[model samples]
Target: MSVRDLNLPQREPSRGELPSRVTIWEVGPRDGLQNEQTVVGLGTKLEFLDRLAAAGLGTLEATSFVHPKWVPQLADADDLLAKLDRRENVRYPVLVPNERGLDRALALGVESIAIFGSATETFARKNLNRSFDEQFAMFEPVVRRARHEGLEVRAYLSMCFGDPWEGAVAVDQVVTAGRRLLDMGCFQLSLGDTIGVATPGHVEAVLGAFDDVTRLAVHFHDTYGQALSNTLAALRAGVTTVDSSAGGLGGCPYAKAATGNLATEDLVWMLDGLGIDHGVDLDALVRTSAWMAQQLGRPSPSRVVKALTGG
Candidate 1:
């Protein structure tokens, strides 16, 4: 599949914040805490997720079903899902790597699930130990089965702008993989700046290539202080779905230098200022991130949190 092959519907130019409501997909629990070096207990993970939920975030990525041998920190995926707070109107999505992982998620009656892929060949092989095409081939049946079971499937495409080893990635490559994921039954596609090198201009260019903004999500890392800028650019490009971590607590395990994701606190502050409705309470978000920072025994990397809390 190619960018031209997507046959996406024509879209009008964006008017910033035209869509008053945006979905802030919180990834602090699964993507954020997974990169922590120390073992964060199951109770702590649950507490962190519950705090985020109480802060008014509706969609939360709870955990990953990746093998314990790989991501040991998230080894409690099953246990966490088993006892997670089932709050009304709150969604708990988990990441599943393959059929086996999907099976586990299904057993728990997971409402939503996410599968990850890479735009570049090198990162795909490095992360999933498979070629680019093989990666989706691996996710194909898993996504189908999960959707068939009435689960909302999200396709996560990483390294959308710059690959650590591959340098600049072609926009068409991203479109191709994203279209394939959507074609394979994914209801949403979250394009990620895995190494955090995407700038605002690149964000606009890439997002412009996608004709349908409703099904698109943007995930950016703050390695170079560009996450918020890139996020605003995506918003200006008509994207209403944004992925962020609370307290900025995540990094790419495959790319050693990949830093924390865009902090949900930072995004909420911007959205609040712009009069955009994210449904998140900035004060509560700050409080939750502050508490999470304490749990980690480190200052939060979020500038907004720092400015607000003097950490």
Candidate 2:
């Protein structure tokens, strides 16, 4: 019984103008574990990264450099990077909240860093402790210095479609915030459906507002069972990078309603069926997530993992 024997997700040829290749930004190591009640040890985290890299996830969000006061789970970011087995083919990106976090990452020679932003004012204040317009001021210097220091920078705009406090976020508002981050030298902008309330139409409209889709990526949560649908909309609109959590292991500490992220295994299955070239081994990914589930003392939330492993 090998992975080949599974014969899952029957591949089919591309039907439309969708990109043949997609970049799946795996966030299970960072965003996926940040909200966990139990702190996963550093050795386990390192092995998790190794397994994900072996499974062919090119870009892995390794961990966050936020202060221990905020996210104690990722407080070992410094140690994790120090002990990590760096791979030439894989890109390890860490989240740097502000100047201090960037300094920590720089001290360890981190090559890539991601900044978190908010598409709505309420989320901005709650998540970043800054006003809607004020959050940019906090991120500008960080992004600028990261670029000047020759590090790849990514921006995450949370609450893109709808916020818990704010019933519905305007498309223009998301575009404005996203553009500001992009203009500040972010190489990529990841639009986050923090509460996962976005539908296909809203996803299309939000992506359409942008002039360039090349630098855009979508990070959808499956809170409303619409992550896959919204992902299809993004692909139709020409977005090639997608953010997903392995094992669907994440939620927002700030947003009570926010649930687990779109699972990497589930996304890979859909990509496989669509004949999109993601370069990830679905069986390996499912096994990795399933193993992670055992570590966390729960079953993986990925539908594909369940279907394949009969969990």
Candidate 3:
């Protein structure tokens, strides 16, 4: 199936209407805490997510259903999923790295799951010990099974801009991967700036290559201080979904010098200033980030947190 097959109606843009109301998927619980050196308790993790939901975050990445041997930090994925105080309107998406991960998520009665693929062959081989086709093949059965069970799927394409081993990724490769995910019935496709090496120009160029059926989202790292700028660029290109961590908490363990993701508080501040209705409370969000930072025994990375808390 292709975008042409979807038969989605085309609409001309009107001046008053914004490109689209962006959906901010908070990745704090899963991505943020996953990289912590110290293991956070299950109770603490649940509390953090509770606060996030109270602060009006509608979409949250709750946990990753990968094997404990692979990601020990998320070893309690099933426990967390079982204990979560499920919100009717809020979506809790868990990361499923392969078919086994997907099965675990399904066993926990998860309705939504995220599958990831890398754009560059080197990154895929390095990270997953598989080539691009192999990784995609691993995802295919999981996607099919999930769809059979009526689960919503989100596909993450990592290293969309640049790879640690390969400098620049071709835009056509990204488009092809994104199209493949969409064809596999993924509800959304998140293009990740894995090493945070993306520029606004690169964002526009990458997004311009995709057709309309594939809804686009962005996941940016703040490594070179380009996350926010790239985010604004994504918005300008009509991207309606953005992924960020609460206090800029997580980074790629594979890539050296890679900073945490773009901070959620900072993103909300920008969106609020732009008169964008994100339905999130900045003050509460700042408080949540501060609490998480205290638990981790580290200073908060969010600029808005510092400014708001007088740190």
Candidate 4:
């Protein structure tokens, strides 16, 4: 079927104080498939990235360079990069846990890399196996080296809104942690609602602490069914970049309560209604997610994908 045959959302006139163009940072290949029980083959992963890029997703998080023991699903990161048919207009970023992961990414000629960090002490110890403050000590060299190598470094600050082990994360605490990553030469910091417990008001409060919204990206999970609303709130606060997983495919391997990242199709639907120019072809994106869901041997959790494909 052609893209025009899909039941697409009608584009309304652009309103409100939101940015005219939003950049949807697609994370399906990396974060989406990292914790899957059914291991997706290397060819499927590469094709997933290709399909997403063909759907007009400009920035695709290709995969993680973490130790295979941690995320065995993405063990073929080296081969994936070597055989990837990279597009000149597309940006493919990989997740690198530390200096060693950075080395692997650097060896593959990766231009952009992301380092994951935690906001709360409990999560830091659990996810990174280091204390909250000590985690930065580890990332400092990674960020510094990546900068020196002329690679753009992005930081992921998890548990920004709420943590399962730790209660409500203070807005100021999140701000300070995010600032540390930014000061260390990271170009963009993605504030993650790891547990998906963030509300719109809480999202506004947390984002309000940051001085520059341009350097901020919001990664929301839909565990509490608030991801899209919180994302809209973030968009209103001048954030243009959003991290979403295609077909709603990922959940935290460490944080069990964290369900899935915001679905790219769902976000695109809301953006379409708001008349936001996100450069994504909604019909094509829905089709891509639907195909990915089939590969995973499950239905997509995305409302937009389900609605468009009658899944």
Choose the strongest candidate by lDDT: 2
lDDT of 4 by residue, 185-252 (tens): 99999999998999999999988889998899999999999999999899888888999998898999
**Residues 13-120 of candidate 3: C-alpha lDDT, one tens digit per residue:** 444444536689999898888778788999999999999999999999999987787678889988899999998799999999888888788789999899988998
Q: Which stretches of candidate 2 lie over 4 Å from their true place?
A: 1-16
Looking at candidate 2, the ten consecutive residues that score lowest on lDDT are: 1-10
* Candidate 2 CA-lDDT value: 0.92
Off by over 4 Å in 4: 1-16
Clash number for every model? Answer: 0, 0, 0, 0
Q: Write the per-residue lDDT of candidate 2 for residues 1-311, one digit (tens) a residue.
A: 22335665554546656888999999999999998999999988999999999999999999998889989999999999999999988999999999999999999989999999999999999889999999999999999899999999999999999999989998999999999999999989999999999999999999989999989999999999999999989998999999999998899989879889999988887887677889998878888899999999999988888888998
The candidate with the higher lDDT, 1 or 4, is 4
Model 3: residue 142 alpha-carbon error in angstroms: 0.5
- Global fold similarity of model 2 (TM-score): 0.96
List TM-score per model, in order: 0.94, 0.96, 0.93, 0.95
Residue 94 error, candidate 3, Å: 0.5
lDDT of 4 at 180: 98
State how far residue 263 of model 2 sits from its true place (Å).
0.5
Q: Rate the local accuracy (lDDT) of all candidates.
A: 0.88, 0.92, 0.86, 0.91
Residue 307 CA displacement from its true place in model 3, Å = 0.6
Better of 1 and 2 by lDDT: 2
Question: What's the lDDT of the predicted structure labeled candidate 4?
Answer: 0.91
Native-structure RMSD, model 4:
2.2
